[model samples]
Target chain A: MTDPTASAEPPSGPPARRRGRPSRAASAGTRDRILTAAREEFSAHGYDKTSVRQIAKAAGVDSALVHHYFGTKEQVFAAAVEVAFAPALAAPDTLAEGPADGVGERLARFVLGVWENPTTRAPLLAILRSAVTNETAAAVFRRLVAAQLVRRVAARLDLPDAELRAELAAAQLVGTALMRYVLKLEPLASADVEEIIARVSPVVQKHLTQP
Target chain B: MTDPTASAEPPSGPPARRRGRPSRAASAGTRDRILTAAREEFSAHGYDKTSVRQIAKAAGVDSALVHHYFGTKEQVFAAAVEVAFAPALAAPDTLAEGPADGVGERLARFVLGVWENPTTRAPLLAILRSAVTNETAAAVFRRLVAAQLVRRVAARLDLPDAELRAELAAAQLVGTALMRYVLKLEPLASADVEEIIARVSPVVQKHLTQP
Candidate 1:
């Protein structure tokens, strides 16, 4: 390796083209760092309360870097939320291969899988919290979840009003999450995920496929 | 007949035991003052954002007086949200008495009553905003809403899973509200409440009473 003080003479020719590997690696690292801080800030403080500076500080980066990478606070939040809910999007594919004897059980398994994982759960908590405080955040969250999670499940059913039913089913699952994880309501908070799916999935499936 | 200077003296002997009529008037006025200010504060800045001090200042009263009258911020918020949702609460009772052949029409009328009025809509926004952000607020809101509005409707329905259906029906109503008002989403936002009710109420009624 060259000495620490040695200059790269080739870089002075044409603005020194950035090596794709280093830039891509640097970009991903910064992006991940921003998301980590955003998840924490948004969860604890909420959307309206969470500032760009706070997130940047937490991530140990300049605030301008966050802005450069994500563009705005909402974008940063949306990116974090997208990552948070990514598992739910993968469920449709997973469920497709599972035996059809018990769609409800499969769906419940998918839902619990997302909510139980610390990686997914924390970001979802932030989204849920933000959805209540900032209207813009809620809209962004609703569109993302509706399209990625709710609609996929809905499409699996053949019903006239599958869209509305899907929304209803989504509400139940989301409501349970709110009560158990966020509100810490009793009985539900203590109940196992399998039990919750056993109790709640038939209701969701009924809404989905039933007339 | 007493001298003007003597009239000012602590009302002479034991304050004349203050009469009943003016006391009632004063109490009503104080209650009204507190509610009116609370509404304005909750409306202007939402539940989590508004403080008792802000409300007290708006109402031209001591913050202690506001607490003395309402007990807590939640109590004040509950009152506001209750007043906001009361008009819609009348739906179950109206459905109980009205023609069942036009169930959708009747239900639509009742839903419109809540959405069209600013007094009802403002505090509702505050409560919903709080429900999304604060766990304590969400628990109280869910309890108050379920007991006062949803349970009443569910009790009138004779179905295998009336409670579950009730929750589902509520999800329809609340989810729609979240979309239309909080998100101010397209089509749903500009669409007349009557049209929404016409479209949605049948689904609600079906969830409630259908096998």
Candidate 2:
């Protein structure tokens, strides 16, 4: 038995495997662990109530390790928001630079994509759930949603009230998500994505270029 | 003094002081009381979690009385929403039908008036908060806001995309409230109504009629 397994003596043998610019498996693995724990903690406790130590404890790592990896709670939230909002956020920039005629389709596809993705939708649901009761979390959410996403879309449009129109479009889309996914309303909840787009895209187009 | 007090009892005791109504109190008073209680409960617990029995109990009445008055929880909620959204709901149909120059000011004044009135604002805040986490609440909210408010405003305008534009305006205004009152963010929280109107009205006007 000793001859057969001579190389497995050290329980932490993986640490020795990194001999250069850091192994992808080691650093990426720790980062993933931290994010998974942070998502759970933030979703459960909300933004204002969630703490670094709590997140670290859940991740089975030292608190210092969380700070070393994520920097701050806001940064972690931003990263999470980036991931959660990526489909929608990425859409505006692409749509602005893409074929202008089908902006409605692009916008609808973007919203449906994000809401349909389970990985991002859960945290987004938590964020929406917390936004009402928790003031601080709501602020973070508003900034990420309004200033970051809607404002950017507004800036891209050539209309007179582009900013306002963009915000309006954002509201309908987000409100639909709140109603369908989080609230689980009847007709809307059961409606297919294409149906949602058919009904809603024209509305978005109106906002973008109706002037 | 005691002799005079005893003598006054002989005069039908001032008509027995009338236990329930008619003593300078209308039947509507009970409705008002129940609505007030419902607002407080919904604000604290949201719509899905708040029960009619709880609202009735808080109003110091029997649950049967609540059912007798409002018929069902949905009706009661609808009444509460109507009262809370009265300003916007009651915005003269003339505003939408009239010439569209000062619509920015009109819309701004209407929104500010609703937010400033405790009677309306409190219940509205509860409804808006609940919309974040509850589906039934959100659907009702969207129906009320969109049909009563947005559709009316859109119908008044001649633009092809009037409905979408009106919705966008609502989003900006509602988003501002969420940031200020619900989220309690700085600068926005402290900003005066006039300031908000000045900044937001042009945007609203653009949505209303910008060619």
Candidate 3:
């Protein structure tokens, strides 16, 4: 493609400055690059220590371009968290795919499975580490995980105190992740994923379906 | 009371240089002060950002004196964790005072009660935040928690995989604390303590006592 919009780098002429807008695909690519860089920077340095300029440097872009794309560091962190957790956040919808009786098992398997995978675990771990120490980051993380993931799962269930139950179930899973992944506590940290699921799913199931 | 060891501060003048040792109580008090300062420093700045010099300054002691007392920052952190968790870690022994069937409820109440109290929660939260980000800190924290807290509770259970079950129960409670305290996730964070006990104790009870 010889299309002017298809170029990965901006054209090297005065006309490049005059261009009204880049193609939608090109904009999306730049946004994705910035997000990837932000995740890496935040993960390595945490919320307080990381800056937009550092993120932009990591992304090989101008700092002003990062501001143009994400506005503020908090907004950038929010966007990064949204990307990191997108898969796990979508996992609650799968509860509908299985029989009502096995929903707990399905939910446990889904949540833990996301954590067990290396591909998703790295970025998610960074967000979690930062969130644990930084209040602002924690707030964004709490809002996203609660609203997008936990509450949605609660809504699907027909039970009293559904939200509370859903959150309780989440506590079990989230705690497991914190211990096994973050804290690296023994037996739990080294134990097989299936074993954890076996022990924890029933608890989750009880929280979800039981009164 | 006339003994040189009874003095709160080092005795004034040349006599101080000739003294063999301070009173045991005074030494312990100095150590306690240092540990308290270490906790505050770690809490405010976390592991990487905290310094031995900073802790010494806060404790109103020379940096060399801090080293003489605690040896290293890691040792200082370990000591701080021990002091911070002393009450909660001791709660397991109380399980012996209650009936087997009620162990889960007692355990949940005891652990959550420790978290509910502000005196212990502040320093413990610092350790948790440090553990989440730094591997060395996490390892030290994991060892102390596993050895001092989780395994001790597991040992009391007559059930098979008592350790695993104990850890699983811990996961639930720990998860609840992470969400409610650290992440401040809603419903769970704001919910009445008794309601949380009513909902979570049974799950914890199941994990510990059930197959």
Q: Against the true structure, whose TM-score is highest?
A: 3
**Winner of 1 and 3 under DockQ:** 3
Query: What DockQ class does candidate 1 belong to?
Result: incorrect
Instruction: Compute the lDDT of residue B171 as modeled in candidate 2.
Output: 51
lDDT of 3 by residue, A87-160 (tens): 79767887899788898899999999999998999989999988888999999999898889878888899776
Ranking by DockQ: 3, 1, 2
Model 1 iRMS: 4.3
DockQ of model 1 vs. true complex: 0.20
Q: Pick the candidate with the highest DockQ.
A: 3
Comparing only chain B with the true structure, the TM-scores of all models are: 0.79, 0.78, 0.88
Q: TM-score of model 3's chain A, to 2 decimals?
A: 0.88
CA shift of B72, model 3, Å: 1.4
A67-160, model 2: which lDDT tens digit per residue?
A: 6665677766665555555556676675665688778778867877788888868877777667677666666677787666766776778666
The better-scoring model by DockQ among 1 and 2 is 1
Task: Compute the lDDT of residue B87 as modeled in candidate 2.
Answer: 61
Model 1: per-residue lDDT, tens digit, A1-211? 2231243121111122344333555557766878888888888888888999999889877776667666678888888888877767776664466655566567756776788777778777778667766777887887886678657765776665555655655555665566566655444566677766766666566555555
- Give me the candidate number with maximum lDDT: 3
Model 2's TM-score against the true structure? 0.60
lDDT of 1 by residue, B56-143 (tens): 7887766765666565788777776676666667877866776665554565566656766776777677666676676666777777
lDDT, candidate 2, residue B34?
84
Fnat for model 1? 0.17
